[model samples]
Target: MVIGRADLHTHTTASDGMQQPRENVRMAKEAGLAAVAITDHDTVEGIAEAMEAGEEFGITVVPGVEISTSAGGRDVHILGYYTNWQSDDWRGRLGSLTEVRDNRNLMIIEKLRSLGIPISLDEVLDEARKQGKDRGTIGRPHMASLLVAKGIVDTMQEAFDRYLAAGAAAYVNPPRLNPFEAVEWIRQAGGTSVIAHPGLYGDDDLVEEIIRSGAEGIEVFHSDHGTDDEVRYERLARQYGLIVTGGSDYHGERQGVVFHGTIGSRTVDAGVLKQLNPASR
Candidate 1:
């Protein structure tokens, strides 16, 4: 079958993305995407708006959330798709997680301030607002945007490499769930859990372990993955009978990583989507 256009990983104003849901959908349609998933960091609030916009733009919007979890002292992001959005259980879990995220962000800001960076929580929130991002639970990408606004660093990678990297002067680890717990929560919420950007983590064994712990898929086609890493991850997924997925991990201009439609070629197939949500089949 000919591959169709899809982007399983994307952000919007509901998280740290520069575009609003409507604008994102419009851009996706313009870019010739058949489907897209708004996998906002730690929140699914953008799904409804994305869905509405998708309907208007004649594209499919997959409900998704990127949950931050921990393993071996490193952060692992698990993408949850086709979740039960209205479930009280899901809301309670997300509320608790959001509180943890907010506290973590405040602590990071305090550390940055102590280092004489002069960044305030209000400044971060203001930056997010200026970018049309949600203010309730600001993320590092949003903070990095603030740094960019102040000319601290040219890009998000530089912001992290200079100050926010683990063991850096202003670095602090956030409270996080274990990988198993994160996958189980996604499963309980009636969503498929996929490991996001394994290439960034540099641990193929851990990816296999996550699949063993009920993660249904692996992100094999990420913008950051080199050709060899992509081939290796694809082989691993096939060896373990896991669904293969990919995306640009788009965060708009904040990261300066890649363009919105540049990574459109990497997409989860419709059969994989059906596997993610059997009802879709």
Candidate 2:
């Protein structure tokens, strides 16, 4: 009988997600959600449409973005909530990061080619185009799809295992923000920064470092988190006096939409939103 009212992490066609912004809103409404955060990766392109659809569908849309950063040699995702997406200053920042992402994709493809994988940028673009993902957001997952299409890999996991994963032959570090930089940018845009899925990252020590890095909140409810993980993060949030947010991290069926009816099988209420961003209330 538990109901979900908010999903603080999600994606749309503006990034690697399968659905368009408006369609994601519709899905949220259909699931009886009152609010959903469109935390598209590195780009705020989908926010406008999602907000528009939210109005039409009677759902509250939190304008957010998931900025990819690196710390301790691991990819860390920082979620920004209630951010001002219309400012040129903010857009310029994301634009630069997107440019870096594009360059990194090319480098990865070059490494793959060098490794005799026969994967090309064009092939990856074709897969991303089919999925309707944005240009700046083309990533290894898109490349993996091309590998599958070419029968070079059996699955996306295999593609990553053989080539794209960190420390793999094709791996290359891209331009990235440090933890502090990521938090600063979100705050600069008048948003609250939250560490996305602490459990997915390294040990509790690293999570503590992120908390100290100026993140105002932490994601406690995620499809990737189990009960112990949730409890651990919740305790950490309380201990550190940081806001607690939750979401399904919904990408789509292709990304394995296991928590379909709820946001990671944990209902998020409006109080968490208010805590994370007073403006959200």
Clashes (backbone N, CA, C under 3 Å), per candidate, total 0, 0
How well does candidate 1 match the true structure in TM-score terms?
0.92
lDDT of 1 by residue, 23-112 (tens): 767777787878888888777778888899988988887788899888887888999989897687896898788888888888999988
Itemize residue pairs with steric clashes in candidate 1: none
TM-score for each predicted model, relative to the true structure = 0.92, 0.92
Error (Å) of candidate 2 at residue 67 is 0.6
lDDT (Cα, 0-100) at 133 in candidate 1: 69
Tens-digit per-residue lDDT, 261-281, candidate 2: 233344478557676675644
Task: Give the alpha-carbon lDDT of every model.
Answer: 0.80, 0.81
Angstrom error at residue 120, model 1: 1.1
Q: How many clashes show up in model 2?
A: 0
Q: Which candidate comes out best when scored by TM-score?
A: 1
